[model samples]
Target: MECIKCKKEIPDESVFCMYCGKKQAPAVHGVKKRGNGQGTVYKMPSGTWAAEITLGYYMQDGKRKRKKSRKYGFRTKKEAVEYIATLKQSPKKEKFITMFQLWELFQTKKETLSKSKRTAYNIAWKKIHAEIEYRQIDELTVPELQAITDKYGTSYYTKRDIKNLLSHLYQIAIRDDYTDKNRAQFIQLPELQSQEREVMTKQEIELLWNDYQKEPSAITAQMLTMLYTGIRPGELLTIKVENINLDEQYMIGGIKTTKGKNRKIIIPDKIKPLLSWLMETGKKGLIAYYPSDVEFYDAWKQKRSQLNIRDVITPYCCRHTYITRLTTLKVSPAMLQELAGHEDYDTTLEYTHLSIAERLQEVNRLD
Candidate 1:
């Protein structure tokens, strides 16, 4: 048998066009034809019934393109018929919207989100937007979304954020009749691992110091600042020229929890000169003008490669190094918590990566 719409050949016993998902009518059964645009219903090979209706039409490539709505798995043809009747009573408006288009619409309606949350969602969007931005939401498949989820291999937080943002977008798509389901909701993220946090080695720190003294550019200055101040990469971007008080040897910057936000970060004498140089050469605006943490991370990655550093040190590792150094210096736990902008001392301890030798020395201190 040939499909009635796409004219594709199929099994003779087929009650629906497998190619087009259109309901098929047998000539012998002589299914009664409804009005011009009333749609159709028929029993399927699975003994269930399916119904489909033409919601609207548009011109594409100089041809009239029809938009359709389909419902399947009805127990009986009468059930399918009733479903179509209800759809005719109040037709659902189909939107030929792309993911990016839906994202724009979603943002306009999401006015209550905090600045941090809004930034998070925007960053997540930037990560995977290029993959499916222009594709129509309805055409997206679960495997496609899962592939995107799997691409970011241990970036558990980023994967979660992307999944969260995509889920929200899919919700909006469903509400607007752009798509029937949220494929993102079905995508799974990698299990979170509790790997030991890494810190910059003494050699890497010396290398950075040497490089800064030799040819100090914006990148080296940024790294030195984070290493000394223990400010998060996200917080590092929030620093402004106005926030620095060089004479007072402190700056105000942070983000995330209340304890972390806009906290006073004391600038070490070692890093003060670098900050002064950066502020002098930097524009009269933000200290580091890379818009997002992702871009800053890219700069960090390139700088590491150029410096020929083999260790997988990250900007956050700089913070860990700072905390470890402070702990080694016997800085009081209260002061350490304050400087790290950690809500609790335990959290501050988590960021401190003491080496085995250092731990042994601490143990020997009991003697």
Candidate 2:
């Protein structure tokens, strides 16, 4: 048998063409003639004789054109007659929409997303959009999504972000009827183990602090601020002198390029004198006194190596230390959430790590 659409030879029993997915028309069993010099009607191999209409028209360029088309397929001649009576009611092939169209639809609705979510969406698009942009929406199989995930690798949180963006794309496609089904629904994410929370010991903090005092670089001030306040190192880098009120002992600023809700942190008495000194001698902006977060982190790493502190605590450890101490002090969950600028309590909870000594103290108190 040959497919009518593509004229490709197919196996005798094949219902759909392998190349084009077109349903093959059964062989003609008989022929008939219609009035007004229309095309001949043939009895389909399925025992149905239907009119194969040929319409003639002049093209826009003045060329004559003849188009032959079939109306319906039926198992019986009577069914064919009935189908011909309502020929206009037959369903048409759905338009083929591409992944790029769906992406455009997603982009159109991106304004409704949060700024961070928008950034995440764009980042994901940047990674794999080019590879699949021209593909039909129905062609985006689970394996393709998996391949993208594998290609991007596990580090840098890009896979997670891409998954989220793809999920949203699928959702939008379904809602808009662009696709009857989402192939990406079955796509699996690489099972990423949660990052081990970096924590700083009291001795380690003291050693780092001592090293900072000796070196007194911008990293030293940044590290001290991170330990004193539980703010993220990225947030620490954005803190301005105007954001800090030394008399009130709190640093008020927006978090992480304004991704987080605006929040304030109470300065610890231990770091109050240091903050006051910075405030007095500090430049017009940036209270933490670092040129950049990268600079601060790199300098801190160098100092850690110099001090030979094998644990190698990151600046983030100070944020964890603050949360740990706050947990020990029995701060309320709501307050802690607000202090950490976490919209969700679960995120704030991840920072809470109780030391063995503190755990033992709590156990003794239980008695």
139-190 in candidate 1: lDDT tens per residue?
7788888888677533888889889889999999889777787888898888
The superposed Cα distance between candidate 1 and the true structure at residue 36, in angstroms, equals: 27
lDDT of 2 at 52: 56
List the lowest-lDDT window of 10 residues for candidate 2: 87-96
Best model per TM-score: 1
Pick the lDDT winner: 1
lDDT of 2 by residue, 23-137 (tens): 8875545576566534455676655466554422222344434434466555655555555534333232133445666788887789897555676677678778766666666
Looking at candidate 1, what is the lDDT of residue 255?
Answer: 84
Alpha-carbon TM-score of each model against the true structure = 0.68, 0.51
Candidate 2 C-alpha error for residue 223, in Å? 3.9
